[model samples]
Target: MDPSILSGMRGFGVATIPRWPWFVFLAGGMGCLACSSLSHLLACHSKDFNLFFWRLDYAGISLMIVCSFFAPIYYAFFCNPYSRLFYLASISLLGVLAIIALLAPSLSTPRFRPLRATLFLSMGFSGVIPAAHAVILYWGQPHIFVALGYELAMAILYATGAGFYVSRIPERWKPGAFDIAGQSHQIFHVFVVLGALAHSVATLVILDFRLRLPTCAD
Candidate 1:
Protein backbone atom coordinates (compact mmCIF):
# COMPACT_ATOMS: atom_id res chain seq x y z
CA MET A 1 0.00 0.00 0.00
CA ASP A 2 1.29 3.45 -0.89
CA PRO A 3 1.84 5.70 2.10
CA SER A 4 0.88 8.81 0.15
CA ILE A 5 -2.42 7.26 -0.88
CA LEU A 6 -3.07 6.23 2.67
CA SER A 7 -2.32 9.71 3.87
CA GLY A 8 -4.64 11.21 1.29
CA MET A 9 -7.43 8.90 2.30
CA ARG A 10 -6.84 9.89 5.90
CA GLY A 11 -7.12 13.62 5.05
CA PHE A 12 -3.51 14.65 4.82
CA GLY A 13 -2.77 18.16 3.53
CA VAL A 14 -2.22 18.36 -0.22
CA ALA A 15 1.42 19.37 0.09
CA THR A 16 3.89 16.65 -0.83
CA ILE A 17 5.44 14.96 2.15
CA PRO A 18 9.16 14.45 1.91
CA ARG A 19 9.62 10.71 1.34
CA TRP A 20 13.38 10.40 1.39
CA PRO A 21 13.42 9.41 5.05
CA TRP A 22 10.89 6.66 4.38
CA PHE A 23 12.96 5.43 1.46
CA VAL A 24 16.05 5.35 3.65
CA PHE A 25 14.32 2.96 6.02
CA LEU A 26 13.12 0.78 3.16
CA ALA A 27 16.57 0.59 1.62
CA GLY A 28 18.13 -0.34 4.93
CA GLY A 29 15.64 -3.17 5.43
CA MET A 30 16.22 -4.58 1.96
CA GLY A 31 19.98 -4.35 2.35
CA CYS A 32 19.87 -6.24 5.64
CA LEU A 33 17.79 -9.08 4.21
CA ALA A 34 19.91 -9.30 1.07
CA CYS A 35 23.16 -9.43 3.00
CA SER A 36 21.85 -11.98 5.48
CA SER A 37 20.58 -14.18 2.66
CA LEU A 38 23.86 -14.09 0.80
CA SER A 39 25.90 -14.63 3.93
CA HIS A 40 23.93 -17.72 4.90
CA LEU A 41 24.18 -19.06 1.35
CA LEU A 42 27.93 -18.63 1.05
CA ALA A 43 29.23 -18.99 4.58
CA CYS A 44 29.53 -22.74 4.41
CA HIS A 45 31.73 -22.88 1.33
CA SER A 46 35.01 -22.34 3.18
CA LYS A 47 36.52 -20.75 6.29
CA ASP A 48 37.42 -17.63 4.35
CA PHE A 49 33.95 -17.43 2.88
CA ASN A 50 32.47 -17.88 6.32
CA LEU A 51 34.55 -15.10 7.78
CA PHE A 52 33.89 -12.62 4.99
CA PHE A 53 30.17 -13.30 4.63
CA TRP A 54 29.60 -13.25 8.38
CA ARG A 55 31.29 -9.89 8.57
CA LEU A 56 29.04 -8.65 5.79
CA ASP A 57 26.07 -9.93 7.71
CA TYR A 58 27.21 -8.09 10.83
CA ALA A 59 27.73 -4.89 8.89
CA GLY A 60 24.32 -5.24 7.33
CA ILE A 61 22.77 -5.61 10.75
CA SER A 62 24.52 -2.45 11.87
CA LEU A 63 23.33 -0.58 8.80
CA MET A 64 19.76 -1.58 9.41
CA ILE A 65 19.95 -0.40 13.02
CA VAL A 66 21.33 2.94 11.91
CA CYS A 67 18.75 3.34 9.20
CA SER A 68 15.97 2.51 11.63
CA PHE A 69 16.70 5.83 13.31
CA PHE A 70 16.26 7.93 10.15
CA ALA A 71 12.52 7.89 9.46
CA PRO A 72 11.50 8.36 13.07
CA ILE A 73 14.09 11.01 13.80
CA TYR A 74 13.52 12.77 10.50
CA TYR A 75 9.78 13.01 11.00
CA ALA A 76 9.94 13.66 14.71
CA PHE A 77 12.34 16.48 14.15
CA PHE A 78 10.86 17.61 10.83
CA CYS A 79 10.70 21.22 12.02
CA ASN A 80 13.96 20.97 13.96
CA PRO A 81 16.95 20.28 11.73
CA TYR A 82 19.70 20.76 14.31
CA SER A 83 18.42 18.07 16.68
CA ARG A 84 17.67 15.84 13.71
CA LEU A 85 21.20 16.08 12.39
CA PHE A 86 22.67 15.44 15.81
CA TYR A 87 20.64 12.30 16.41
CA LEU A 88 21.23 10.93 12.93
CA ALA A 89 24.94 11.62 13.10
CA SER A 90 25.22 9.96 16.49
CA ILE A 91 23.52 6.76 15.34
CA SER A 92 25.54 6.65 12.13
CA LEU A 93 28.78 6.87 14.07
CA LEU A 94 27.72 4.09 16.45
CA GLY A 95 26.69 1.91 13.53
CA VAL A 96 30.04 2.35 11.86
CA LEU A 97 31.89 1.51 15.05
CA ALA A 98 29.72 -1.56 15.57
CA ILE A 99 30.49 -2.75 12.05
CA ILE A 100 34.20 -2.38 12.69
CA ALA A 101 34.07 -4.28 15.96
CA LEU A 102 31.97 -7.10 14.57
CA LEU A 103 34.17 -7.33 11.49
CA ALA A 104 37.23 -8.05 13.60
CA PRO A 105 38.18 -11.71 13.15
CA SER A 106 38.97 -12.05 16.86
CA LEU A 107 35.65 -10.53 17.84
CA SER A 108 33.80 -12.82 15.43
CA THR A 109 34.72 -15.89 17.37
CA PRO A 110 32.14 -17.81 19.39
CA ARG A 111 33.57 -16.45 22.61
CA PHE A 112 32.57 -12.95 21.57
CA ARG A 113 28.93 -13.75 20.80
CA PRO A 114 27.79 -12.14 24.05
CA LEU A 115 29.81 -9.05 23.26
CA ARG A 116 28.23 -8.76 19.84
CA ALA A 117 24.78 -9.17 21.29
CA THR A 118 25.50 -6.50 23.88
CA LEU A 119 26.73 -4.18 21.20
CA PHE A 120 23.58 -4.56 19.14
CA LEU A 121 21.42 -4.00 22.19
CA SER A 122 23.41 -0.91 23.00
CA MET A 123 22.81 0.40 19.51
CA GLY A 124 19.07 -0.04 19.89
CA PHE A 125 19.07 1.51 23.32
CA SER A 126 20.89 4.55 21.99
CA GLY A 127 17.55 5.69 20.59
CA VAL A 128 16.34 6.31 24.12
CA ILE A 129 17.60 9.87 24.16
CA PRO A 130 15.97 10.99 20.93
CA ALA A 131 12.84 9.02 21.67
CA ALA A 132 12.46 10.79 24.99
CA HIS A 133 12.88 14.09 23.27
CA ALA A 134 10.21 13.27 20.72
CA VAL A 135 7.81 12.23 23.45
CA ILE A 136 8.40 15.46 25.29
CA LEU A 137 7.66 17.35 22.11
CA TYR A 138 4.63 15.35 21.05
CA TRP A 139 3.24 13.86 24.23
CA GLY A 140 -0.15 15.49 23.74
CA GLN A 141 -0.80 13.50 20.55
CA PRO A 142 -2.52 10.17 21.10
CA HIS A 143 -1.10 8.61 17.98
CA ILE A 144 2.44 9.43 18.99
CA PHE A 145 1.98 7.45 22.15
CA VAL A 146 0.33 4.66 20.20
CA ALA A 147 3.21 4.54 17.77
CA LEU A 148 5.62 4.52 20.67
CA GLY A 149 3.82 1.50 22.07
CA TYR A 150 4.60 -0.32 18.87
CA GLU A 151 8.22 0.74 19.09
CA LEU A 152 8.35 -0.54 22.64
CA ALA A 153 7.12 -3.87 21.41
CA MET A 154 9.82 -3.80 18.80
CA ALA A 155 12.44 -3.24 21.47
CA ILE A 156 11.22 -6.14 23.54
CA LEU A 157 11.18 -8.42 20.54
CA TYR A 158 14.69 -7.46 19.57
CA ALA A 159 15.92 -7.83 23.11
CA THR A 160 14.37 -11.26 23.42
CA GLY A 161 15.97 -12.27 20.16
CA ALA A 162 19.32 -11.08 21.36
CA GLY A 163 18.90 -13.00 24.57
CA PHE A 164 18.25 -16.15 22.62
CA TYR A 165 21.20 -15.49 20.38
CA VAL A 166 23.55 -14.96 23.27
CA SER A 167 22.27 -17.41 25.87
CA ARG A 168 21.59 -20.11 23.27
CA ILE A 169 18.21 -20.79 24.82
CA PRO A 170 16.43 -24.09 24.24
CA GLU A 171 19.36 -25.63 22.42
CA ARG A 172 21.58 -24.77 25.33
CA TRP A 173 19.41 -26.86 27.55
CA LYS A 174 19.38 -29.94 25.32
CA PRO A 175 22.35 -29.39 23.03
CA GLY A 176 22.18 -31.95 20.16
CA ALA A 177 18.40 -32.10 20.40
CA PHE A 178 18.20 -28.94 18.36
CA ASP A 179 21.26 -29.41 16.23
CA ILE A 180 19.30 -29.40 12.99
CA ALA A 181 16.17 -27.54 13.97
CA GLY A 182 14.69 -25.23 16.63
CA GLN A 183 18.08 -23.81 17.26
CA SER A 184 18.85 -20.58 19.08
CA HIS A 185 20.25 -18.77 16.06
CA GLN A 186 17.25 -19.76 13.98
CA ILE A 187 14.86 -18.54 16.64
CA PHE A 188 16.89 -15.38 16.99
CA HIS A 189 16.51 -14.67 13.29
CA VAL A 190 12.74 -15.17 13.44
CA PHE A 191 12.44 -12.80 16.36
CA VAL A 192 14.56 -10.25 14.52
CA VAL A 193 12.24 -10.41 11.51
CA LEU A 194 9.21 -9.99 13.73
CA GLY A 195 10.88 -7.11 15.51
CA ALA A 196 11.61 -5.39 12.24
CA LEU A 197 8.02 -5.88 11.16
CA ALA A 198 6.86 -4.24 14.36
CA HIS A 199 9.34 -1.45 13.85
CA SER A 200 8.00 -0.90 10.34
CA VAL A 201 4.52 -0.55 11.72
CA ALA A 202 5.76 1.97 14.26
CA THR A 203 7.58 3.90 11.55
CA LEU A 204 4.44 4.09 9.44
CA VAL A 205 2.42 5.24 12.40
CA ILE A 206 4.98 7.96 13.16
CA LEU A 207 5.02 9.00 9.52
CA ASP A 208 1.26 9.29 9.52
CA PHE A 209 1.36 11.26 12.73
CA ARG A 210 3.89 13.65 11.28
CA LEU A 211 1.67 14.20 8.28
CA ARG A 212 -1.29 15.02 10.51
CA LEU A 213 0.16 16.38 13.70
CA PRO A 214 0.00 20.19 14.08
CA THR A 215 3.35 21.85 13.72
CA CYS A 216 4.82 24.19 16.33
CA ALA A 217 5.70 26.62 13.55
CA ASP A 218 2.04 27.21 12.82
Candidate 2:
Protein backbone atom coordinates (compact mmCIF):
# COMPACT_ATOMS: atom_id res chain seq x y z
CA MET A 1 0.00 0.00 0.00
CA ASP A 2 1.15 3.54 -0.73
CA PRO A 3 2.12 5.38 2.42
CA SER A 4 -0.01 8.31 1.34
CA ILE A 5 -3.10 6.13 1.20
CA LEU A 6 -2.55 4.77 4.71
CA SER A 7 -1.20 7.87 6.46
CA GLY A 8 -4.28 9.21 8.20
CA MET A 9 -2.48 10.82 11.13
CA ARG A 10 -0.81 13.67 9.25
CA GLY A 11 -3.88 15.77 8.60
CA PHE A 12 -2.81 18.85 6.62
CA GLY A 13 0.67 18.71 8.22
CA VAL A 14 -0.64 18.33 11.76
CA ALA A 15 0.58 15.24 13.61
CA THR A 16 -1.80 15.57 16.53
CA ILE A 17 -4.86 14.23 14.72
CA PRO A 18 -5.22 10.54 15.31
CA ARG A 19 -5.50 8.22 12.25
CA TRP A 20 -8.35 6.08 13.50
CA PRO A 21 -11.05 7.07 11.04
CA TRP A 22 -10.70 3.94 8.99
CA PHE A 23 -10.56 1.83 12.08
CA VAL A 24 -13.59 3.62 13.44
CA PHE A 25 -15.46 2.69 10.29
CA LEU A 26 -14.25 -0.88 10.39
CA ALA A 27 -15.16 -1.29 14.01
CA GLY A 28 -18.58 0.21 13.37
CA GLY A 29 -19.22 -2.08 10.44
CA MET A 30 -18.12 -5.13 12.39
CA GLY A 31 -20.20 -4.16 15.35
CA CYS A 32 -23.27 -3.66 13.15
CA LEU A 33 -22.78 -6.97 11.41
CA ALA A 34 -22.17 -8.79 14.65
CA CYS A 35 -25.20 -7.29 16.29
CA SER A 36 -27.36 -8.12 13.32
CA SER A 37 -26.15 -11.68 13.19
CA LEU A 38 -26.67 -12.12 16.88
CA SER A 39 -30.13 -10.59 16.70
CA HIS A 40 -31.18 -12.98 13.99
CA LEU A 41 -29.60 -15.98 15.62
CA LEU A 42 -30.77 -15.42 19.16
CA ALA A 43 -33.79 -13.09 19.00
CA CYS A 44 -35.97 -16.15 18.77
CA HIS A 45 -34.58 -17.28 22.10
CA SER A 46 -36.93 -14.93 23.97
CA LYS A 47 -38.92 -11.73 23.65
CA ASP A 48 -36.57 -9.85 25.97
CA PHE A 49 -33.50 -10.97 24.02
CA ASN A 50 -35.27 -10.05 20.81
CA LEU A 51 -36.00 -6.53 21.94
CA PHE A 52 -32.57 -5.96 23.45
CA PHE A 53 -30.68 -7.38 20.49
CA TRP A 54 -32.71 -5.37 17.99
CA ARG A 55 -31.96 -2.20 19.90
CA LEU A 56 -28.29 -3.10 19.89
CA ASP A 57 -28.54 -3.61 16.14
CA TYR A 58 -30.03 -0.16 15.72
CA ALA A 59 -27.29 1.36 17.87
CA GLY A 60 -24.68 -0.37 15.75
CA ILE A 61 -26.16 1.14 12.59
CA SER A 62 -26.08 4.57 14.18
CA LEU A 63 -22.46 4.04 15.17
CA MET A 64 -21.54 3.10 11.60
CA ILE A 65 -23.17 6.28 10.25
CA VAL A 66 -21.19 8.37 12.70
CA CYS A 67 -17.90 6.72 11.84
CA SER A 68 -18.56 6.92 8.11
CA PHE A 69 -18.17 10.69 8.15
CA PHE A 70 -14.63 10.59 9.47
CA ALA A 71 -12.40 9.71 6.53
CA PRO A 72 -13.88 11.61 3.59
CA ILE A 73 -14.47 14.83 5.46
CA TYR A 74 -11.07 14.65 7.11
CA TYR A 75 -9.24 14.19 3.82
CA ALA A 76 -11.32 16.36 1.52
CA PHE A 77 -11.27 19.41 3.75
CA PHE A 78 -7.81 18.96 5.20
CA CYS A 79 -6.40 21.94 3.34
CA ASN A 80 -9.05 24.28 4.70
CA PRO A 81 -8.76 24.07 8.43
CA TYR A 82 -11.81 26.17 9.28
CA SER A 83 -14.02 24.40 6.78
CA ARG A 84 -12.72 21.08 8.00
CA LEU A 85 -13.44 21.95 11.58
CA PHE A 86 -16.91 23.18 10.78
CA TYR A 87 -17.89 20.14 8.78
CA LEU A 88 -16.47 17.75 11.31
CA ALA A 89 -18.22 19.51 14.14
CA SER A 90 -21.52 19.60 12.30
CA ILE A 91 -21.45 15.90 11.49
CA SER A 92 -20.40 14.99 15.01
CA LEU A 93 -23.32 16.96 16.39
CA LEU A 94 -25.71 15.31 13.95
CA GLY A 95 -24.42 11.88 14.90
CA VAL A 96 -25.03 12.59 18.57
CA LEU A 97 -28.53 13.77 17.80
CA ALA A 98 -29.27 10.69 15.77
CA ILE A 99 -28.10 8.44 18.58
CA ILE A 100 -30.23 10.21 21.12
CA ALA A 101 -33.27 10.22 18.88
CA LEU A 102 -32.93 6.55 18.07
CA LEU A 103 -32.46 5.57 21.68
CA ALA A 104 -35.91 6.80 22.57
CA PRO A 105 -37.99 3.71 23.22
CA SER A 106 -40.99 5.10 21.38
CA LEU A 107 -38.96 5.77 18.24
CA SER A 108 -37.52 2.27 18.27
CA THR A 109 -40.86 0.59 17.80
CA PRO A 110 -41.70 -1.05 14.44
CA ARG A 111 -44.29 1.59 13.59
CA PHE A 112 -41.61 4.29 13.63
CA ARG A 113 -39.38 2.50 11.16
CA PRO A 114 -39.83 5.23 8.60
CA LEU A 115 -38.85 7.85 11.12
CA ARG A 116 -35.72 5.94 12.00
CA ALA A 117 -34.74 5.56 8.35
CA THR A 118 -35.38 9.24 7.74
CA LEU A 119 -33.19 10.21 10.66
CA PHE A 120 -30.29 8.16 9.37
CA LEU A 121 -30.79 9.34 5.80
CA SER A 122 -30.78 12.92 6.88
CA MET A 123 -27.50 12.37 8.67
CA GLY A 124 -25.97 10.89 5.53
CA PHE A 125 -27.35 13.62 3.32
CA SER A 126 -25.90 16.29 5.55
CA GLY A 127 -22.60 15.65 3.78
CA VAL A 128 -23.91 17.61 0.82
CA ILE A 129 -22.78 20.93 2.23
CA PRO A 130 -19.23 19.81 2.79
CA ALA A 131 -19.19 18.03 -0.53
CA ALA A 132 -20.34 21.09 -2.37
CA HIS A 133 -17.75 23.14 -0.53
CA ALA A 134 -15.05 20.71 -1.52
CA VAL A 135 -15.92 20.98 -5.17
CA ILE A 136 -16.09 24.75 -5.10
CA LEU A 137 -12.77 25.01 -3.27
CA TYR A 138 -10.98 22.61 -5.57
CA TRP A 139 -12.74 23.31 -8.82
CA GLY A 140 -9.79 22.73 -11.08
CA GLN A 141 -8.52 19.54 -9.57
CA PRO A 142 -9.23 16.26 -11.40
CA HIS A 143 -9.16 14.29 -8.16
CA ILE A 144 -11.89 16.48 -6.74
CA PHE A 145 -14.21 15.56 -9.56
CA VAL A 146 -13.28 11.93 -9.26
CA ALA A 147 -13.90 11.90 -5.58
CA LEU A 148 -17.11 13.79 -6.02
CA GLY A 149 -18.30 11.26 -8.53
CA TYR A 150 -17.65 8.47 -6.09
CA GLU A 151 -19.34 10.38 -3.33
CA LEU A 152 -22.35 11.00 -5.52
CA ALA A 153 -22.53 7.31 -6.21
CA MET A 154 -22.29 6.65 -2.51
CA ALA A 155 -25.15 8.99 -1.80
CA ILE A 156 -27.37 7.43 -4.42
CA LEU A 157 -26.68 3.96 -3.14
CA TYR A 158 -27.40 5.01 0.39
CA ALA A 159 -30.61 6.72 -0.58
CA THR A 160 -31.73 3.67 -2.46
CA GLY A 161 -30.97 1.53 0.55
CA ALA A 162 -32.97 3.85 2.76
CA GLY A 163 -35.87 3.64 0.33
CA PHE A 164 -35.83 -0.10 0.50
CA TYR A 165 -35.62 0.04 4.25
CA VAL A 166 -38.49 2.46 4.60
CA SER A 167 -40.73 0.81 2.05
CA ARG A 168 -40.05 -2.75 3.18
CA ILE A 169 -40.51 -3.62 -0.53
CA PRO A 170 -40.80 -7.28 -1.47
CA GLU A 171 -41.46 -8.32 2.09
CA ARG A 172 -44.37 -5.93 2.29
CA TRP A 173 -45.73 -7.04 -1.02
CA LYS A 174 -45.62 -10.75 -0.37
CA PRO A 175 -45.45 -11.02 3.37
CA GLY A 176 -43.69 -14.21 4.54
CA ALA A 177 -42.75 -15.16 1.00
CA PHE A 178 -39.53 -13.13 1.25
CA ASP A 179 -38.84 -14.01 4.85
CA ILE A 180 -35.71 -15.88 3.89
CA ALA A 181 -34.15 -14.80 0.62
CA GLY A 182 -35.41 -11.56 -0.85
CA GLN A 183 -36.25 -9.32 2.04
CA SER A 184 -35.84 -5.58 1.83
CA HIS A 185 -33.67 -5.59 4.92
CA GLN A 186 -31.17 -7.93 3.30
CA ILE A 187 -31.04 -5.78 0.19
CA PHE A 188 -30.63 -2.71 2.34
CA HIS A 189 -27.63 -4.27 4.07
CA VAL A 190 -25.99 -4.98 0.73
CA PHE A 191 -26.43 -1.36 -0.33
CA VAL A 192 -25.04 -0.17 2.99
CA VAL A 193 -21.85 -2.12 2.39
CA LEU A 194 -21.60 -0.77 -1.14
CA GLY A 195 -22.08 2.79 0.07
CA ALA A 196 -19.31 2.35 2.62
CA LEU A 197 -16.95 0.93 0.02
CA ALA A 198 -17.74 3.82 -2.30
CA HIS A 199 -17.01 6.30 0.45
CA SER A 200 -13.71 4.55 1.16
CA VAL A 201 -12.66 4.89 -2.46
CA ALA A 202 -13.62 8.56 -2.47
CA THR A 203 -11.64 9.12 0.74
CA LEU A 204 -8.56 7.50 -0.76
CA VAL A 205 -8.84 9.73 -3.79
CA ILE A 206 -9.11 12.80 -1.61
CA LEU A 207 -6.14 11.67 0.46
CA ASP A 208 -4.07 11.25 -2.69
CA PHE A 209 -4.97 14.77 -3.72
CA ARG A 210 -3.97 16.04 -0.29
CA LEU A 211 -0.64 14.27 -0.58
CA ARG A 212 0.20 16.18 -3.74
CA LEU A 213 -0.78 19.57 -2.39
CA PRO A 214 1.71 21.71 -0.48
CA THR A 215 1.54 21.49 3.29
CA CYS A 216 -0.11 24.23 5.36
CA ALA A 217 3.25 25.39 6.72
CA ASP A 218 4.54 25.86 3.20
Q: Which candidate leads in TM-score?
A: 1
**Residue 212 accuracy (lDDT) in model 1:** 73
Assess the local accuracy of residue 124 in candidate 1 as a C-alpha lDDT between 0 and 100: 94
Top-scoring candidate (lDDT):
1
lDDT tens per residue, model 1, 1-218: 58666566554442445789888988998898899999989999999999899889888988889999999999888888899999999999999999999999888788889899999999999998998999998778887798789889999999999999998989889979998889998898898899889989988988878777554464
**Model 1 vs. true fold: TM:** 0.91
| Candidate 2: tens digits of C-alpha lDDT, residues 1-218 | 45665476465453443467667767877887887788778878988777777777777777787788777788776667788788878888887788777767677688999888888888888888888888887899999999989989998998999899999998888889998798998999999889988988887787667766656653
lDDT of 1 at 38: 99
For candidate 1, the lDDT comes to: 0.87
Measured over all alpha carbons after superposition, the RMSD of each candidate to the real structure, in angstroms, is 2.7, 3.4
RMSD value for candidate 2: 3.4
Off by over 4 Å in 1: 1-16, 214-218
Q: Which residue pairs in candidate 1 collide? A: none
Question: Candidate 2 versus the native: TM-score?
Answer: 0.87
